[model samples]
Target chain A: MGKNNVEQMILNIPSDLKYLGAVDAAIQDLAREFSFSPDAINDVSTALVEACSNAIEHGNHFAKDKRVVVTLRFNGGDFVATVQDEGRGFDFAKALRDEAGPDPMSERGRGILIMRAFTDDLKFKCDDKGLTVELTKLRGGGGDAGQ
Target chain B: MKITQREVGSAAILDLNGKLTGGPDADAFRDVFKSLLEQNKKHIIVNLEKVSWINSTGLGILIHNYNTVRGAGGDMVVMHASERIESILYVTKLNLLFKSFNSEDEAVRSFTAAR
Candidate 1:
């Protein structure tokens, strides 16, 4: 695929966890269209789901009136997804700087770590409107298919 | 998610199907653990062979249930986790905390073998 052949898809949903399946489906389809390896597709799908979950839970606080917007962009072999939530975001830098990380037994606080692990690149931007987390993964970057 | 409970020897196995992500699924899973504890069934095995998807929230639910079971002097282990689910567990290092198995026989035998 050529870089010029860019495809973009957008999804806007309420801050409900129920809609996560739709996001996963969309990412899977787009990754397949880009000819991403199965492992890469799974990586993208998993990372994006974590991003959206954070947007819905932490950013939007699951407020009924709040909304989460997801934008997927495919360019050549790169798949990029941005999750935006209408709420004040947390300190991404501070969270990452905590070398001790979260308690091994803790139930929460692993979402960000999972998102960072499965994606090639993860970026965050907080503005007056809300916080947007951008995740990027490259086709064939999933390494060994067996894993 | 759907959870079906059955007893094999002294272990109570929860066969889970569908996504374990948070929401109603989390509540249902919690309730199942609660019921198990009330029944004095402490040894638990979570069979994830049919579960298609799991996110951080789902992991949270599992951790919460694991802690609850452990606190009740019980134990929880998982079996048949997909590569995707395993990836999440590995990333979060929960793999170290939760013992995993590849087969039902091995998982079921673990409870007996532990003693």
Candidate 2:
């Protein structure tokens, strides 16, 4: 693939956890197509799953009527994934701050932290439609993958 | 996730196969742990040799159960975690909290050794 050419894949699923495997499979295939290292592929797959989980559990509230849409794109140098949900969004910044405490025993709030640790860039957007989490991984970033 | 329980000496080992993500898996894991606690099996070892994937939610499940076991005056350690799972635990600094061993024998020995 040329640097100027972009490849993309979109996955739409209900707010169900069982479909997460499909999301992971799609991410693995795309990451491989981009020649991501084995560790990098795992990194992207993990981060994407976190993003999708948040969308399903938090944003969509597990409503069967709701949907989580994921977009995966690669532009030769970077792989990006956007997970969008169909519900009102929560406070991303506050959640991150609350989870930043020294307590390691807390069982409820490490999703965003893990996403940040594994991805090169993380962005969140909330509006009337829903919340969209954008995650980007730079090719060959060699950033603590599977550490 | 599929959980199989076996007792090696006094330690109850929960061998897990498949992804340990949240949802029904969390409930199933909790049920198993609760049953163990009811049986007074405090020392526990989580065997993750066959877990293909685990995310933060799965890690959270582990933390909750680990705390539960500790509160009951017992301990829970892990064995055979994949490199990917280890990475998640490391990034969360949970590697410091959970004693991990490469083999089941070592994990079972940790309980007796601690005494």
Candidate 3:
């Protein structure tokens, strides 16, 4: 059932900011193949950049030995992407609570909020190994693909 | 992003072309803003007309610079954000933080009109 209709792709990028452009281009191409609207493509692209940036900066600590892996899958008209890092995980619950506060002028902490706002579903997984951020976007419409 | 700066009265207009995503410490951007601050040009206008895309890191760069300028008793504004970039700002509520203008003239006028 999983392989029947779902197509998946993976990208592994070194913990360097320069590779973010390639990540965005790859996600844009995948979104195009799925016929996501222009707005949807933009949201996904921005979210992917944020997730990958966080992985490279926070999770991988910009260490050349570390790598960030991105997996993208289109399943039954919905898109799912995951960004994984090799460093210790962070406090996802605290990050979410901070985003819920009313501090629009704050410079930091908005990356996760933007990802959560754009994607239908956002989940963070942490273990002794590392951190992984999962993002989902449903077909059609703009702004948070979930109804 | 490729950034070019010029003086519009006391305001510094930064014209950015290309995606304003990750770079090595985003040095290119940081350098330009640093120069502006050194020159005592606190009021800044970032022209995003040619920028096709931006992400959280890019936004963070802008916000970081914004605070720096504000701390120095100056300010920063953005103009000509493409529809998609505007959407990112709106989603993050950054649209409320950095004042936005539709045209370079309007942005320049704003800085001069303030003082």
Candidate 1 residue-wise lDDT, A38-82, digit = tens: 888889999998899888988888899999999999987688899
lDDT of 3 by residue, A1-147 (tens): 242289999999999888988988998988888778877887888888889989998899899999999999989768899999998988888887775634766656777877887888889999876899999888853554222
> Which ranges in model 1 have alpha carbons more than 4 Å from their true place?
A1-4, A140-147
Candidate 2 — what's its lDDT? 0.88
Error of 2 at A8 (Å): 0.6
Model 2 per-residue lDDT tens digits across residues A79-145:
9899999988888877766545347988877888888888988888998889999999998675444
Question: For model 2, what share of native contacts is present?
Answer: 0.70
TM-score against truth, every candidate: 0.94, 0.95, 0.90
How does candidate 1 fare on TM-score? 0.94
Ranking by TM-score: 2, 1, 3
Interface RMSD of 2: 1.8
Model 3, stretches more than 4 Å misplaced?
Answer: A1-4, A99-102, A141-147, B22-25
Model number with the top lDDT: 2
